[model samples]
Target: MKSSIRRRVLLLALLPATLLALSLGYFFTLSRITDLDQALRARGLAIARHLAPACEYGVISGNNQILQRLADSALAEPDVVSVYIMDRGGNVLASNSLKQSKLAGIQPGDIPVSSQNDTVTVATRSNVLFFRMPIRQTEVQVDDFALTSTPAPAIQPVNAAPLGYVAIELSRKATMERQNEVLRSAALLTIAALIATALLALRLGREITVPIMKLASAVDKIGRGYLDVRVKLGGNDDEFRILEDGINGMVSKLHRAHDNLQEQILQATAKLSYQASHDMLTGLINRREFEVRLERALFSAQHQDREHALCYMDLDQFKIVNDSCGHVAGDELLRQLTLHLQQEVRERDTLARLGGDEFGLLLENCPQDKALELAEIMRKTVEDFRFSMGEKNFMVGVSIGIVMINHESDNVVSLLTSADAACYAAKDHGRNRVHLYQMQDSELAKRRGEMQWVNRIQLAIAENRLQLYFQQIQPLQKQEQGLHVELLLRMIDESGQCILPMAFIPAAERYHLMPMLDRWVMENSFKLCDAYIAPDSCELQTWAVNVSGASLCDAGFVQYLKSHLVDNPALARTLCIEITETAAITNLGAANTFIKELKSLGCRFALDDFGSGLSSLNYLKNLNVDYLKIDGAFIKDMADDAIDLAMVEAINKIGHQMGLLTIAEFVDSERVLLKLKEIGVDFVQGNWIHKPENAEALCKT
Candidate 1:
């Protein structure tokens, strides 16, 4: 039961009864006591006034016997305890008690008279009241009496007015005795009434609380998972009947709601599980689920000592399909393809969607030859199947790369990389074909993996792990000439072994980590050049650094170059930025912008690997460059091949026409160098001049 309702009803039934009884009792009892006190005060005042005249007459006549007689008359009253008389100037003239000592003198001005009736309480005792009254004299035959005393009055004025005051002291013992008797009787009656009311309230409360307690216990049981429990309200007409009805209604509604909520929860959980394991569009197993199955398949193959092949398939021209037919058609085609591939594959084989337009097949107990045969069949199936989108019918082809699981390759990355490389080779050789991974390809793949490690190498640079190696790029014609050095990036691995950039650069570009790696090389390269480059050399030959395409596009590159140049202006002019033709051609706009901005700062640009990519005459005309590096490919074969020599000659002629100096790369033999010199190449760099070596080793050479 709620205390608020119970308390409100109790107060309504009991508060007025308490107040009326208290008011009636106080009015009858306390009012009578107050009236009695007023009567006593009036009687005491009357006695005091009647004796005041005689006392004043005796004081004026100087009669001690008469004053003592008047004091005795005032004390003869029922409640008067003592009395005193004082002159107008506040000197005590006589008293009924203390004949040897006069009352302490009262200053007339200090006396207060009541404003309502000129009555005052002259003196107070623990159980008595004292009053003072001023005596006025008539002009006819007023007697002036002087009383004899032990100490004379301080002064007496000759024209002094005859004034006196009567003091009355009333005893309080009788009043206190009456008040105590009344309070004792009232307290006894109040205690008896409280006991009677408490017994009656206890009986009434039990009548209501017993049913309420039963209802509360039922509610608690229902709250603690016993939904079937119900309250038994004994009185059908009471408030508990309403409470019991409400509880039953709530429990019915809760049961219906719980069933509905449980159904919804189960449906939502199933939907989430489906979305987690399968692709939303094609309804095929997603990459995460596919990888889980692939890992298991690989482990089984290893345990059973049987061959298993993982073929990664990617759709060719899927972007074109999306662009032409829209993503809706693309999604429909993928769904159709998934169904077809599922039908074509063996029941035991696993077909999964790796990502957008990419699929994987896990063939258990299948050799490389069998896996290749299946991959070709899948490719043919895709090529032969005609897909209709709205009005157009088209055929799609796939590139498949297969990796056989073996004891040597146990990790997912290794297997995936091998498959990816084979896929790339298939696409490169020509799409719509299948390629098997080979051991020789693993070296290239391993190099690519190391390039991925380049990102970690860049992080190492920030942590000061990038060190420099200087190699001489000498002129074949003049050995005495101070050779300009090319700066090589060397990473100090965790084991303290040096790793060269050739082992990591390609991976850095593939993974888009080249910008950070390039910046590290630039900052550290300049710092090393500033510290190690000799100032006394005649030419003050520059140090060369290769920059990435991403770094070329960096908006901060120009500012970075300007700040470094500002720090070392002369050495800045001696610093050369080497860029490959591939990087220059890929992002021509940004490359031009960066080159022009830095060239204006007195920095030189060297076109690295000149003949390796699509090095057009248009780029040479548009790009303001200082050096043309003949690609190492032509120089490596220059000694024995006539085509290589002719290509070099053609490049030299083009460089001279463009007014750019030409440098031959990969000058690995004396004959290649002589051929380069004959071609009028301005510089040469290869093992023939000097192989890349540490700074200390370069200096010693």
Candidate 2:
């Protein structure tokens, strides 16, 4: 049980002592004082009554001596200041007073009394009480004392009239003196009690507050992460002791939890560090980690007179496995190939998976010949390794490109580029081979040129330097399809010279940049149509713009077209979107979805370079298209070669059977045009039909 602070404070302070003294002394003093005043008043009234009766006879008889003796007797009692006996004519017949001057000429009969008690009136002022009694004669009823003399003549009927008055004054000095003495004793008792209470209160507060303040200091330390702090309090069976035990227990638990959390944090940090630098798939360092180590290797080779070799390895026939057995088999094959390469490489070499089907090896402190030997061994290991998934077994090979690193080596970028160029050269020459990087290799120069073209193409697109040209798709049948023109893309170099599409288009497609180019063409073509041709004025003038396979697969391109048509829906009618035959078949689902969505917006689709694929007719049946432009390879030579002529005639017939209009491209001569018309091809587009012209010419017209 906890000790009560209320009980302890009351016992020590003893407040009831002061309160009892104040209350009892006050009431006791007041009672005594009241009794003294009442006694004075009672005495005054008794004197007045006695004097009145005694003065009545003297007043009637006009005897001043008897009245004076009676007044003097009344004044003699304690606290009686003055006594007066007056006659009916308001004359002071006799008076006795302690202070004669105080009573001289004072008419007690004229004084208004505050209260009337029958024949007596009492008035008190200034600690003095006045008592007045009227001396009225009453009829006396008395038995005869002698010889029964006939009731003593019936005691003679006395007149009931006031003959005179008697008044007495009393003093309150003695009562006031006793009350003051009682108050002084009460004040002394209160002061003594207060001094004792204050001393006791100080001791009690020290006992309680010291323990509480000590506990508070310990708790503050615990709050500041000092888990070892514990409250040490000295008390038996008290709340402070119980509270101290609870705090110690809680801190102990918190210390253990904090230690456990610290260990867990360290373990998690190590795991995350490993995951950040290594690939989870093959347990090998990833490209970022590989590049960091390569940077170090380059520094050592440049400054420390060390020789290192970097080999960029690309797996050949990787796509065949992915295409044949899906990505699962491809992944398993890569894992197995990683193990095989690891077994052939030295422990000092750093092997990393650069990206999909590409791996990089850094052989530090190695000669060129030893690097070559090691590269060949790794190539042969991968070439001979067979990855088996269930009943299917696959053999894949790797092409190795080795760039020797020495003090003469360039930076990381140059070394990586040279390695990659050499790897490409090995694949180009023959698969499962090793090639050393050389500065003057023609393949490396070509690769570098293509890289330069990639940058140039990006810059050209940023600067809006791509131009559009139009070639007329002349209709051989002369139908109601007003006019159709195919738009061609050309690039304006930094020198402002127009570069043909063949120069940059292959590079753009190789780098998956065709989608950006396609969007640019579509946006500008709509703008050109809006400015030059009104929808109502030339409703049937269709402008055909080519869209690439990458653009067809991209869902964003579909939304781009939708948003533009939503703003100007009529432009869809004037635009014809052309897609190559191979691109359509490669991404058949996305292409079909793309074609259907745009075709619903009044846009027409033409299968460009038709009959280019092996199964063109089979794929064509599934594609929803309005036109098929025969592959120019067949059309350009159909005039001279029989096989080309037969191919063109067969494609035109098949297109018509499928209810699609056929257009022949590369119709360079009039003979080819006449042959296309005879073959029932709906359109012929080439220099012979109409030389290509700048699209801006249409705006001028």
**Candidate with the greatest lDDT versus the true structure:** 2
lDDT of 2 by residue, 507-582 (tens): 8887788988998998888878878766566554778899999999889889989988877777787788889999
Angstrom error of the Cα, residue 49, model 1: value is 5.7
lDDT of 1 by residue, 77-181 (tens): 877777777777677676765232223455656545443245344444566655676654534432346445444444322333546777766776888788777
**Candidate 1: 10-residue stretch with minimal lDDT:** 151-160
TM-score to native of every candidate shown: 0.69, 0.79
Q: What's the CA RMSD for each of the models? A: 9.2, 5.6
Per-model clash counts, in order, read 5, 0
Over all chains combined, what TM-score does candidate 1 have?
Answer: 0.69
